[model samples]
Target: MGTKIVAVYENGVLRPKKKLNLPAGTEVELIIRPSLKGLIKLFEGVEVKKDAESALNETRERKLWE
Candidate 1:
């Protein structure tokens, strides 16, 4: 399982906003990515007639035989 935490980059180190459960000297991998709020705003003005759930169900039904 993987854990997700928000962190801030300071002078040089990345500081986690919350405390972690890991012990001292434990090595962990980091996957840095920006928030999606900004990306979502890019399509704010767009409109769609079909909801995601309905479209996903339609696609799944079509591929059921294959």
Candidate 2:
């Protein structure tokens, strides 16, 4: 895991931004930490319920295809 790969924490999982050449079920240690932007986003305050609800109700899916 020496190669640093950036991933986005979407929903409740880390989605890698690039293709990985690893096999399935590979047990690797993960150092879960927030990026600078993510740390700053924490102070963005509560999102509006209407906006949040609308976003959640959308039909579009989020996929990690890089």
Candidate 3:
């Protein structure tokens, strides 16, 4: 079974927001994914050359309907 938890990286360590129910010295794999809020903040105030509809139409014309 796999568990999903939110964690923060601090001082070269990953600190889990909540305590885990695992024994000491337990090994687990980590798959890191940024949160939605984090992604939004990452691209905040970024400029775009074209609107969404225009971009989609261009993509359809070049890729789908070509």
Candidate 4:
């Protein structure tokens, strides 16, 4: 199962903003990408979450069949 979640890189670790549905000790990989603050601002007053989720879902689907 693949999913995307937000986190903060603090000190020397990445802290998730919310609880995750992963089993204990389940090793996970990290693909760090910089935050797009400017793009977000350009879409100000719009629903950013839905757009981001859609983009991620599309990418995941494409990668799954690759």
Best by lDDT: 3
lDDT of 2: 0.66
Model 3 misses residue 53 by how many Å? 8.6
Candidate 2 matches the true fold with a TM-score of 0.52
Clashing pairs in 4: none
Which 10 consecutive residues of model 3 have the lowest summed lDDT? 57-66
lDDT by residue (tens digit), candidate 3, 1-66 = 898999988999999999999999999999876676765775578665799788667646865323
Root-mean-square deviation of each candidate, in angstroms? Answer: 8.5, 11.0, 7.5, 9.8
Ten contiguous residues minimizing lDDT sum, candidate 1: 34-43
lDDT of each: 0.74, 0.66, 0.78, 0.72
Encode model 1's per-residue lDDT on 1-66: one tens digit a residue: 899998888899999989999999999999876556643664477555699897557646966322
lDDT of 1 at 63: 62
lDDT (10s digit) by residue, model 2, range 1-66: 277789987799988999888899877777776676865575367454577566445413432111
Question: Which wins on TM-score, candidate 1 or candidate 4?
Answer: 1
Clashing pairs in 3: none
lDDT of 3: 0.78
What is the Cα-based lDDT of residue 64 in candidate 1?
31
Candidate number with greatest TM-score: 3
